[model samples]
Target: MVVGDASLDIDTLVIGAGPGGYVAAIRAAQLGQSVLVVDKEYVGGVCLNVGCIPSKALISAAHQYETVKHASSIGIDAGEVKVDFGKVQAFKESVVKKLTGGVSSLLKANKVQFFQGEVMFINENEARVFNEQEAPRYKFKNCIIATGSRPIELKAFPFGGRILSSTGALALQEVPKSLVVIGGGYIGIELGQMFSKFGTQVTVIEGTNSILPGFDTDMSSLVAKKLKAQGVNVVTGAQAKSAEQTDKDVTVTYTVGDKEEKVTADYLLVTVGRRPNTDGELGLDLINIKMTDRGLIEIDDQCRTSVPHIYAIGDIVPGPALAHKASYEGKVAAEAIAGLPSKIDYKVIPLVCFSDPECASVGYTESEAKEKGYNVKVGKFPFSANGRALSLQSTDGFVKIVSDADTGLVLGAQVAGAEASNLIAELGLAIEMGATVEDIALTIHAHPTLGEITMEAAEVALGHPIHTFVK
Candidate 1:
């Protein structure tokens, strides 16, 4: 029987070479399915090549530069710190190339065939893969769509040399002397903060009252204060009208309250949000694959689409548009396709923002927990009181824990401090395993480490924090 359209026979076909697609293809191959992956662009998708890796590389370089600039405060007498933009760019590119090559090798080692082309669904069981020169048909018993999203382009400010998106911002040959970021979400804030650290005069304009609108208001306020302390200008509750470009700079006009103001900068980065890659032209409408109002494919708990043999994952489907989330979903879809019971535990997925002092959160927020009618008990511990933070001289934020008041079960955790992203895994596990405040507090965290803050926060929840006396 012919499956969705591969010219060659295949048991399973995954479209898109993103973290989700490649992972799904490899897993299906390991499960003894003849699998083929179709991708029009570079393998490993945006995360490996442009989005995550490159952004983090810039963050790393900026962090180092900031540390060196402030070395004297930490008792290090390092003098006259200099940044080489070319070297920074080279390092970022090398990291991406290595990771991209690794993904390709893993797929090859697993014996999964790959096609470099744009894919369109021909029917529930068939698809067409086309390159610049030729078009090929692929049919499969099962199909997985993992095409990822792209940066949202605003009509008023078209991207060119002066105006850019997250993708273009990451590929800068030299850091701009000044930057104007259009959105204050994680993508915009993180990149803006990195540029600020790299000595760029950065300005962040958000339509909301504060940065990181997805985060709690208090958290966002605290982050905004930190950004201000770093000499970054944050203009919130402002709406951009348009952008005007000149030979040396670009002027952005925005409305704040009753009046309009104009700000000039060397570069403008737009990071409003992302849109699903599904165009409805992929023959999905013909096959009756349901989609949400936003055009995100509708999938069940098992990652199955309306069509029995077809599945959808990643940015193409609903949920957080994160690579890790997509990768895990890919594994679940592959296992389910192999007749194995697999379900994605969406609650345990952590969201991290790699700003200078990073931010990470998992499970429900305190507000979300309370809205869901759970009597919540909140606990907080500041890094300023942590000895390790004192030694590192990066004491700038805190960790907040939310737990069920009656059951004492960990419900959520939010951290905004040094290496906050790395420290979030324990909290994610705590939430997943339904660990209580006492359970985390009694675990005896190692001394002089950032992890002690986690335990201390739990202890504070128990009304007995040892490090800092809490009244």
Candidate 2:
């Protein structure tokens, strides 16, 4: 079906209706431009249909189950808690349906035309959309490419029912008695820890010496300690060799140092990393779009491609493969297409790992600050010292602040504790606004809120932290 002004034709064409693509289309349409969005799969892409929303739903349920089990400690009396995996799966499906439906409605509301098919670039200004039965070609004045990323399946063990990817892992029919996760990245650790609360014997294997290789060693080590406290068997500096699947379970063979070892489980979750999703029959090469060595599309600060009229954003672009990052880039591309000068601040992009006690950081890490030759001062406040965390019985982590020692400006912030995802937003804004350590410390955060931890951490950086004795 054709949409928008037939006389004016189309102003913008967005390929791949993921977060970035959809947001770009909506923004362009809002600016009184005709927009057409094409996708091979669902409108919401992997983030809504598989990756972010679905996994988070499962994590939420797992957290609730864990809380119920320990309700007595918080003076809330609850009996033995049992999980119905079928119900959990159903709930996740329902959540996806609602969100996907919302995305569809948003597209319709913005007067953006939607096509269900694969899109390939015929040239710089034209694309051909092909479905199972027919292929149609369309020309556009501008385009936004937002094809997202896919999970990197280990060569040793491919994806199947028993040996699952992150997508398949979320669709389990029953909670396995034992689960052996093959990677110690965020996906593996978060999902593995959740299953452990459901009484699954969870083992995490990481090739590196630590689980979260991206974060600071001290913070990630504390996360390991919490996982160990919860009875998760974390094997660091370990490599998986092969996998053998029987009718009952799968046995994973691995090596650590010079010794070979084996672990058997009802299911295996592989979450090594993600690669760019630029492998389809999309004629990217035909259009002469430059790409990175890692296959990510090379775009300028304005999200403009080598072909000036065409643009790209999200995982397919060279940055963190995050939904919010893609969304921001999408807005920038849309505004630029509408004749407005727009650019994204890459430094202010926030990253969050949604584990039981979440981990979040924005800007540079302490190591990164030191590497950049900044005189850095680090400050930390344990959640155990916070009244809100103690009241909620989740005092297992801390909030750390990194600042420019000479200028007292807040350079970065990291938190490894409850609601870290939510708290990181404040830090994101702080960095974006160029707030100093004194600005945060002087702001009166409510007495019993988790946000007070931020103020205290900033105070600690200034050497006048209240509430706890400064060492």
Candidate 3:
């Protein structure tokens, strides 16, 4: 990385060293290309730094706390659980440090040079990288723009002292006595549930009639029921009108139907959604690259932009803004640069929400399979019937399989229960490999395990469920 007038030449330049960018760089370098990856921030991007990794760490801590506090019901007499949030944050940071360090090491091993600075397009073939003290120019044959998105901030509840974004909420030193969460989406629900388990009075305000709006009522209803039992105040069909912040606390005023209501809390958390990082720095207009009206870059199946040499992936491009999705696209873009025929397949991408008991989905839902004009055959098996779930005292949800009625092809699957996050991977593989319900049923799952729920669900689809009687 040299500063001044002369430009260093490279085969590929990847901007925004998040999951997509870093992965793209490594893959490109592996395929015998000179790759230089640059970002305005850290290597592992939002997921490793503040988003997925840290939030899950905190959620795990919260879950452990709740488990110990309520273990008396299971014959364990654990007395008086107290939370040291400072230590919890330390644990989260340690995990982040280890992962980020590992990512840095991986990049180094791949022979991909990294720059911790911002990159702006000099042209379609070139970019200028700069930091506080040094600025360098680079001319590359190709580029991959993988800049990720950031949390959207509302004008009425500006983030700062009392108003918090998802990032701000995760960085809190102490858990508040009370919290008002605006938006009952997965993020809001996950964070709200975490705080609730930590002894915070949580009130979730959502504009939809029910929480987790995009999910099916059958799956989301389990979450809503669990939240109610945890004493989380879920006010659906409401809009967050405004908020007032003081040093001591924040008061949020929202509306339900025609009525106006206000709630005072220690802090206000806004988790509506995220906006892509395509606005200010990258200068996409300079290169005349095409973008959508929603500010997302338009890309083909190979993650190639309008400019053949330039590609885009991750949140900046269309589709769900998930880390794994970005990483998958990253590989495709890198392979395309290497003259390989790699492309993206959205059907097998699994999405998991790390809420209490968890929720996971792969491919289409039952309604989605039907809407897609498939002869949908639905089968569901409750966790209550699973011996492992019963023994673990986590019989709150079910595993559902959606397959084609005639062909018996596994169209999609959903899991809502303990280990749902881990369990969805097998279903994703099933869909990816074009497996049938009978295939899954014939493949033996270990006895009395949670995974048997999936097998039983497949058996239910095959019309011969073992655990539960059918008419």
Candidate 4:
């Protein structure tokens, strides 16, 4: 406890009011716990304030701008179109404000006391939250830490001025004339493609052989084709060495094999990866919380940490750094604290990228199933055959399904095309419920719908396809 600090007792104290923490706090309150939530910054966290929502808004706006400019081929002629970036920024900010305000109202309705301050653990059950003025001590029966991660800054390129992080990229007042992106992960690809659509010359330098390295080559290739068509210069297998920034522009030095190359841009955006915000003033060491070498707090199936009364979830825990994953774990952690049998299952967590021809995957790929000693039946159907895709002029991708050869169980599925983000939910539910390819195939999908693509792929798996010729 700090000197001359008043202590407030809480039944549950949740740190970091991001998707994970806010959800956990609400759930805990619903379960009869008097909860208190504290966030150092925005109530909706990075995903709302800067990351997912804002990025998607920009992506959507860019698509509108692109469509209006190039709709002549379809005979829907619109005259010369231009983007007012100030209005775009206004739109994005309005979205953020609405969502974050909703979250605050939810907390108030749930009777969850909210505070905004930096949290530092004083002991196992006590923490001090401090802002610019006062520090208040909080004593809790249970605690949940959901502090999210931040962009990993490379030693060679620190974020400032012309060198920007994802948050910095999203907050740009005006679109840059040119951008050099280091790292080809989902964050890099989404921002790079968004800028390219807005008429910015984007050069993506990736260390691996392909962009979106986590995805299968087939899916990544489609996105790569779209990026190229959008005039994004993709440099695969390239290493970013350093960045030099001036008032007007920035230059990046990189090497591939034996050749060193230099690229100049209006700004440099680095999205290498994210590091968990675990090693801050929140003293996990003081309470001896078991953590990994990478600073991820170790948690059990129910999200319980080494300490029985404490739980950890989201980016600080061991799993994918996804907002949905964090929100799901948040519910589980809150339920577990209330004596519910809630455990985590990583198998059905979906991964999505909002790049052109969006890519989404849940469960095992064919190779992963084979490596795990399962006889897998793979079915693939291209969007080129789908009437809905043809109508949308987005026939550039496919739906691939991986199933158990013996039982026809839907082990996993991948989608790369329009509405891939929304279409993956059914696949995730199928995997979670142990649904089979036969189940999906037998279910009637509306005519000329994107979901029919999944049904056709299941038909391919079951040895009877309607749309495509079987080999």
The digit string of per-residue lDDT tens for model 3 on 154-245 reads: 98888899999999999999999999999999999999999999999999999999998777678789999999999999999999999988
User: Over the stretch 1-471, how does candidate 1's per-residue lDDT look in tens digits?
Assistant: 323333666899998899999999999999999999988888999899889989999899898898889889858888799889999999999999999999999999999988887877777777777777777787789998898999888999988979999999998898899999999999999999999988899999999888898876666777788899999999999999999998889999999999999999999999999998888456778789889999899999989998889999999898989999999999999999999999988998998888757889999899999999999999999999999999888788899999998999999999988999989999999998989999999898899899999999999998888778877
lDDT (CA) per prediction:
0.90, 0.89, 0.93, 0.94
- Per model, state how many residue pairs clash: 15, 0, 0, 0
Best candidate, lDDT? 4
Give residue 273's error in model 3 in angstroms: 0.3
Model 2 / residue 242 / CA error / Å: 0.7
lDDT of 2 by residue, 343-433 (tens): 8789888888887578988998998999999999988999999999999998978889999999998889899899999999988899999
| TM-score of candidate 2 on Cα atoms, chains taken together | 0.96
Prediction 3 TM-score vs. true:
0.99
Candidate 4: pairs in clash = none
TM-score of each: 0.96, 0.96, 0.99, 0.99
